[model samples]
Target: MLPLIPYALALPLLWATGPTAPDSLIIFNASRTYHYQAIFISPAGDTLSRERITMQPSGQPWVGQPKRQTACTIQYRYNPGDSLTFAARPNPQNQPGRQPQAYEWRKSTVTGVIENPQEIWMHPIRSNQYAYTEVAPFPQVRPADLHPGGSWQANRLFIMGGWGAFKGSVRPFYQVKAPATRRYGNQNLAGCWLIESVGQHSRLGNSYLDFYFHPRYGFTEMHYRFYDGTQISLVLEGLPTGNK
Candidate 1:
């Protein structure tokens, strides 16, 4: 199946010191749009396909039912997969500030609003009849838990267009590695934390994900590697400047 969910994100750099997650990763300006790039890697480590995706915040969502609006729509230039738009739901505390205290991915659909969406929640152009059950919430790195632990699990539905979706528990373990210096478009990413997932089970098999985040930046980028050795990497190029 074609790749979906650009935000399902991380990376490494040289050893620095203990890295801490920033205040919020989803702290982009709501009125502006930003551009990001994705590099598709082959088993042989060759560039398979590259595309420029656009992220723009709107009152409407791109993948699910239209009743719910005002999400950040991410448009893709390649593949039949439709663009994906998602919103960030602030932490329950609802702290008063320009940056959110904490945020979970949100998608509004005809059935209802889904918090902490899974990959399947965002649909491609040809995908249909998508449904999933949230057995549990995926583990995330919190302020208190600067370092993640092993055996973090979440049960949910993952739908890809090929056969059908899978309903089961997903244990996404984390390897909190040493701090590294990373960058986007020559701009250095500050206080980056690199976390690698051991692997996840799907209808196909086990695959892994590497995530990069900054205490202040939030969910910076991610790389997904399939068992077949196909690697998909998505990175944040720059934060949106303005509505222009």
Candidate 2:
């Protein structure tokens, strides 16, 4: 079951401002767009393909329905109505034999009141292969104080289907690690909060996600390890430039 803490008790701590406070660490700008490069890696550590991804705020309300009702509810920092749209296109120079055209564009809604918001719902805009709707909410209660070593668990209803279908639950146990620098392209991102999680899926087996959130850059990097031994890394490439 999802853990619950009264909102009245969490509000004061969530709004407190400081270098390590949750308010300062979790920042989102709804008006700005984010660009990233998605690198698909094989189980052998070879690069399989690359795609350019763009995420922009839609400024629209959440109107989609979940496959099952959520088990928990809590007030979110961002309006529940707000959503983000994500589109991905194959990089010009992708690996040969890789079908870049298989990539699909998605619209997703995120909800949570702490460091990282869980993607509760996802809809494909260009493809009819699969979708995800949260059947449960993430835990609202977190450490009273935010700092390295702080830990929490977030569980979501994992519902995916289309040509193939699977319905189950995924719970990722998250831990806050010390800030560090990571290299992306020609730039070195420093002072990024390293948040890591490990979880087991009913259909996908075991997996893990490493997320790096920058104080000023928001979500900068995400590394995913799937059960099948495939790894996908998404690195922020900054905002789109020029006419793009």
Candidate 3:
């Protein structure tokens, strides 16, 4: 058995560690539950849907420390009419920081396996549609890399062409604008930095853009506006609670 750490020593260490962004591009609190309120608008600027769901870590709640031979499967309980598992990785290893490396993100549907590398912070994270087997590099931003006046290029890899003629497609690179700090209710976001990133030349021009994050919560909110003037905003409705 391992020796137990004394309270005096452990307390300070815990304080020193504090809260940190996960190495993976996506900001997820593996241990906590998040409540998100989503408001969707239609093409003619009409309200479409309002959804509120609590994301609970349904399986393998904690991702083991990086660099080990572990089958890291981070699953979240999501209900979109049916039960779903949000992510999977047969093999996961510890990566440096959230800057240059990435892990895998997956979605399993009756059709086939849709896997994409979770690198830079970009999304629309290929849903469970069409058997797109080719793994693509979806690039964007890392939490540690976000700061005032800092910008990063978004270059995602994807498959293009017809249904049967699926060919590897490299989307055009675009820039993501990061705010130095976001002000809320006449004040700046305290305790953590708020960064919003958007894809400059996304397909719908506005869709698949405006990904937001907070260091403490990793993507506390996301604002998406489609080319047709439809607006959808997702915000964290409460504080995260978990085993930690």
Q: How well is each residue in 179-243 modelled by candidate 3, as lDDT tens digits?
A: 44544333455444444444332232423445555555555566665444546666667667554
- Residues 49-116, candidate 1: write the lDDT tens digits: 56665655453342433332224555666543212211222222233343443222223222211112
- After best superposition, candidate 2 residue 5: deviation in angstroms? 23
| Per-model TM values vs. the true structure | 0.53, 0.55, 0.48
Ranking of all predicted structures according to lDDT, beginning with the best and ending with the worst: 2, 1, 3
Clashes of each: 17, 0, 6
Q: How close is candidate 2 to the true structure, as a TM-score?
A: 0.55
Instruction: List, residue by residue over 71-171, the lDDT tens digit for candidate 2.
Output: 11211122212122112323222234554434333334332222323221112111111121111122222434136998776534344332122244556
Which runs in model 1 stand beyond 4 Å of their true positions? 1-29, 59-70, 79-141, 148-151, 158-170, 242-244
Residue 180 lDDT in candidate 1: 65
lDDT: worst 10-residue window of model 1: 124-133
Which candidate, 1 or 2, would have the higher TM-score against the true structure? 2
* lDDT of candidates 1 onward, in order: 0.42, 0.43, 0.36
- Candidate ordering by TM-score (highest first): 2, 1, 3
